[model samples]
Target: MDLDVFVTAHRAEWDRLEQLLGRGRRLTGAEADELVALYQRASTHLSLIQSSTPDAVLTGRLTQLVARARATVTGTRRAGWRDAARFFTSAFPAAVYLSRRWWIPTAVLSTLLGVLIGWWVAMNPEVQASIAAPEELRAMTEPGGGYEAYYSSHPAASFAAQVWTNNAQAAAVCLVAGAFLGLPVLWILFLNMANLGVGLGLMASAGRLDVFLGLILPHGLLELTAVFVAAGTGLRLGWTVIDPGPRTRRAALAEQGRAALGMAVGLAAVLFVSGLIEGFVTPSGLPTWARIAIGVAAEAVFLAYVYVLGGRAARAGEVGDVEAADRTASLPTAA
Candidate 1:
């Protein structure tokens, strides 16, 4: 257990590994084999020192040395388009499908809450009064009112981009905030639904409920579904903090975190589609039923993507995590 003596004995091997890593020249077969042997020995030395008689400076040096050597040995591979294709086709949906239990209920509850709040606001004049003044409500609900005018107020392309950016940011926040036990996610969802309810109430009380549904249903169905998926995945992540099951807390969180990140990306694409519908279809002169039919079709396509491709991937044991080879190698632990 003499640290100085151990360093003296293995210093040559460590130096050799370092030299091999630093060299710009290609290594010969024998030299490459030797580099591998030296890297293994250095790794063993680092483990022993970490476990017993750990020294800060020596440990740090060895840590860096081992990392460089390991990377050199493995060789790095940059991600290509194939990775993107695999991610969309397999990883993204599988992640969503696996987290369905959490988000599906989230969608149901949030919708019911929106409806309840709408009903309350519609039935109770006081609630409507608290939300907005009579003049404001009238301005919002009159024919060619604010609710209908809002969508067409801007150019379609710019408006779609703006909506996409905003929705994507919201979804990202939901996924990232799950680290705080999902409280933020729930609050965000509540706020979103409350706003929807307020609008519903104002329109219904104006006897323009049909007008409101027609406008919202065109894009709201798919748009809100993406938000629900994000929120649900976040809640699932928060629950992972509470119950990591058989896996160590760190491991479970790490796994879920990766999946959540992937979901963030996939959900952005979903939100983009909804944004297009909202920007173009919602404000168009098409009949309400036709616009709603378009929205329903988009929602149905997304759901099918999740259940069909995602379900198949999940059944085949994809958890939406990165490939094993891409994961960081865990250090050796004592039994």
Candidate 2:
């Protein structure tokens, strides 16, 4: 039953029963006995109802009651982005961080992508040249390629915007496309890694590794983490179907799916945020020290926030302060 309805239905009868027992008021035989029982039942460590004025106690109880009513009324609304963040701040790290070793696979995927992309672009020079730049500068592919010339000729603002936009799109694809079982996620991960590998490989083969890493690594760390997380989530989903353990596939899928989505969302935000930094900040090929500093600082902040804050709120047995429980118990149920 709904909380307010339950409270309303029970409060009047309870109040009448209390009146007969004379709690918070003068009492004689039965009322005194009942009041004594109420006190004994509610004498928790934080029993604010016993400690605070009746008015303060009643007010707090009524506020909670009204709040529950309001929540019931606003069924259309759910928590917002902040709520999502709060959840990620707690859940992601708890699930992933106890074993920081989990990140090794992600790093390996990223490195492999780098290598493959380099090879692919090398093999498909024409496609590389085309995607990297248009025909007017096709010759830029010849000597260390035209990537440098392209960035040099383009305005800083424009380059940043393009890079940011591209990363944003890639991250989105990484997130959505990785939702299937392990294979799909693995493919997507490889596809992205290869793409990056080739793109950078083209640059590196052309002798632009310094420029590429400088521009990409700062934001790439977070952006790539987000992508790997997406892939991992997919693996999680696939595992559910493949190994369901003792639970039925359906049940395991639901439980793991919720967690995977949570991971996906966390990664999505990381991508977007990192994309912003990439597009505007590092894309300029900012000083080496500054880029490293920013990257390290960003990772640290993310790690600290995620692992530290989640699920610390009142858990089942330990939720309310003793006072809250005591106060709640004392309130007339019907009101």
Candidate 3:
């Protein structure tokens, strides 16, 4: 009960503990044992002071020291291959499946918008004229023209890397901007769809719609799906900010933010596949059907992974957040 006596008694042990901790990783075996013993004694000292005294300053210092000591004693766990494997197999897919409500609608609406715009541009000569001069349009959509040449402009490796970087950047933007109510995400999607429509219209007007489809479908299927997933997750994050349901707005945003992050990482891998297709398959001598089939097969596998592995993970109560043991304790609130 006597604070001064207690401090004097334990001060040397606390100082020794600090000294051992400061030794970095070169502690001798005896010192290691001594450090553990000192840590336990300091913990007991902290508990006694907390129970018997009202000294905020002393309590805070002990609290910090105890935490540091505990960490030093337990050591940190480095992420290993197993962690990465578990994430891809369980965490990433669950996040994708959980956001299916958002991404699926995004895919459907974007497709419809692109189709309508393409049709409008294709059917109207005036619209085509507005897009480009006759000479320029011809230079682009004509056989062996700019549209076809674009994919082969660079070496396959460089082009694939470029596509991957650009797509990853776009996905990252969608995720980071989700905090802004997903306005940027919507704008990005609109711009992408409009560009597609313009391309479709220009090619169709030139009677090269088949060629355009041939080149695009081989990569665009998976590429556009990844974009949709990114945009959808971003929109969902924004909605969480607006309507947090039963949880506090902060809690809801935190949860959605984590899921969005997981999608960002997973989408990078997905985009890589599409990048390979765009760089290689789109420009290859293979038959159009074969190229399109490759893209379709890749997309089918991704969807199945989400529905099967991710669906099961989600049903088992995984929302792609940190494990419960790692999460901070939340204060109790009325339902």
Which candidate leads in lDDT? Answer: 1
Residue 226 in candidate 1, Cα distance off native in Å: 0.7
Task: Please give, for residues 199-237, the per-residue lDDT of candidate 1 as tens digits.
Answer: 998899899999999999989999999999999999999
lDDT, each prediction: 0.91, 0.54, 0.86
List candidate 2 segments past 4 Å from native: 1-85, 95-103, 116-179, 306-335
lDDT of 2 by residue, 55-173 (tens): 45544654444333333323335557865554554555544443234445766856876776677776676866666565533455444345445444556666656765665555445
In order of lDDT, best first, we have: 1, 3, 2
Q: Worst ten-residue run, lDDT, model 2?
A: 314-323
TM-score for all models, in order of appearance: 0.85, 0.55, 0.80
Global CA lDDT computed for model 3: 0.86
lDDT of 2: 0.54
Q: Choose 1 or 2, whichever is better by lDDT.
A: 1
TM-score, cand. 2 vs. native: 0.55
Candidate 3 lDDT at 118 equals: 97
Q: Which ten residues in a row have the lowest lDDT in candidate 3?
A: 325-334
lDDT, residue 17, candidate 1 = 86
What is the per-residue lDDT of model 3 for residues 1-335, given as tens digits with 9 covering 90 to 100?
98988888888888888888877577888988998888777777776675466478887877677767777876767778987887899999999899899999999999999999999999999998898899999999988899999999999989999999999999989887888998999999999999999999899888899999999998899899999999989999988888888766766787788778878888999999999999988999999999999989989999999999999999999888866544423433346
Span of ten consecutive residues with least summed lDDT in model 1:
326-335
